[model samples]
Target: MTPRIGLILFTALLMQCENPVKTPLPGAETIPAQIRQTDCFNGGNALFHAARITEMGNRASGTPGYRRQIDYLKEELAKYGWTCREQGFEKETPQGPVRFVNLRARFGKTPNFLDPVRGLLTCHIDTKQGIDGFTGANDGASGAAAILETARILSGEPARAGNLELVFFDGEESFAEHMDSDDGLYGSRHYASAMQQPLPKWMINLDMVGRQGKKIRIPSMTPQ
Candidate 1:
């Protein structure tokens, strides 16, 4: 999945908020009108955000660059009326116990707005460890940019935006070269464990997306 694909998917999901049916009926015109009314997702803006993220340098978990990235994301989300909370946790990894924080955003001004949402849009924000000069332009930044743009567009549709959550997961990359049960996905794992009952109906996880010439492949076992 490249950035363009991610943007398309996010736009389509928001369209569904207006129409929940799986299949579109004939002469359905509301979606087009909605698109025209709201600020459309801008590919140029997303790329600019991605570039800004990459400029922060290495974002390996527990690093200064990672902290900067988190702060930047929070600032950007706040401008669009998103209230973000840090889901901080400590995990024992192969290297040692590391502190990781997952940023969760909901569309509102209320601090205690813990409502049951319809969907979750997620992406990993940490770059691979032990790599020299690894900016993770496509892997880490692109997905975040896509989500940020989605949040901006959704801000105008409070009714629809309230039924969704945006998450930027940390420590998604493993300390070792390869991932295993003991490593990787630290933030997401903790979040899933801590979530209350009646979770979001669906979730979309984006990673290594937004690269030009990249193609998205669906698994064979995916339901229709």
Candidate 2:
């Protein structure tokens, strides 16, 4: 991956300090300005996808909306010439074993169990279950929208030195109101298990990206 482009893109799309989205963290003063000048990382594009994804109704895992969400993502990514696939699996749930699929888009060969890549950008497409009228506009849709927009932007650029992958996970949220160890992060856990040597050196996971003018909270665990 081109660290300069990827870092700048993610910094613009995800960075948050004490300030709001419009506000810059110290020393990264030129980032937002540079972002505005680029064709990639368009907020409007992300918002458009967010709105469309929201309209699919609640994307609770195992629901028809969730399947439609998958279709939409596959369709959109195919337009950009990226190879797409569904990694389907069945896992036990409170109700029973439910099927889930993770959508992956890549610039190189189809993803293998241990395919090595320079960077992986991902977000959950599944919204929390059991909530009435829960659209997950910010929580579920935002990150996926950002990923879609990122794919569009990156597709137009020249190929990178290493492979790039974009993944939309299907079961990030638990079926229960509150998460239990056995219930959540099904997609990521599966992905991690399948990882091989030379795992992605850089990965960005996005959530709650649609809130207006909200501040970013960089975790203490984040690498400096």
Q: In TM-score terms, which candidate is top?
A: 1
- Give the per-residue lDDT of model 1 (tens digit) for 58-165: 999999999999999999999889999998899999999999999999998884546677788999999998888889988999999878878988898998788888
Candidate 1: 10-residue stretch with minimal lDDT:
28-37
Candidate 2 per-residue lDDT over residues 47-81, each given as its tens digit: 77888889999888889999999999888877666
- TM per prediction: 0.82, 0.81
Candidate 1 Cα outliers beyond 4 Å, as residue runs: 1-38, 111-113, 215-220
Candidate 1 lDDT at 213 equals 41
Q: Candidate 1's C-alpha lDDT?
A: 0.80
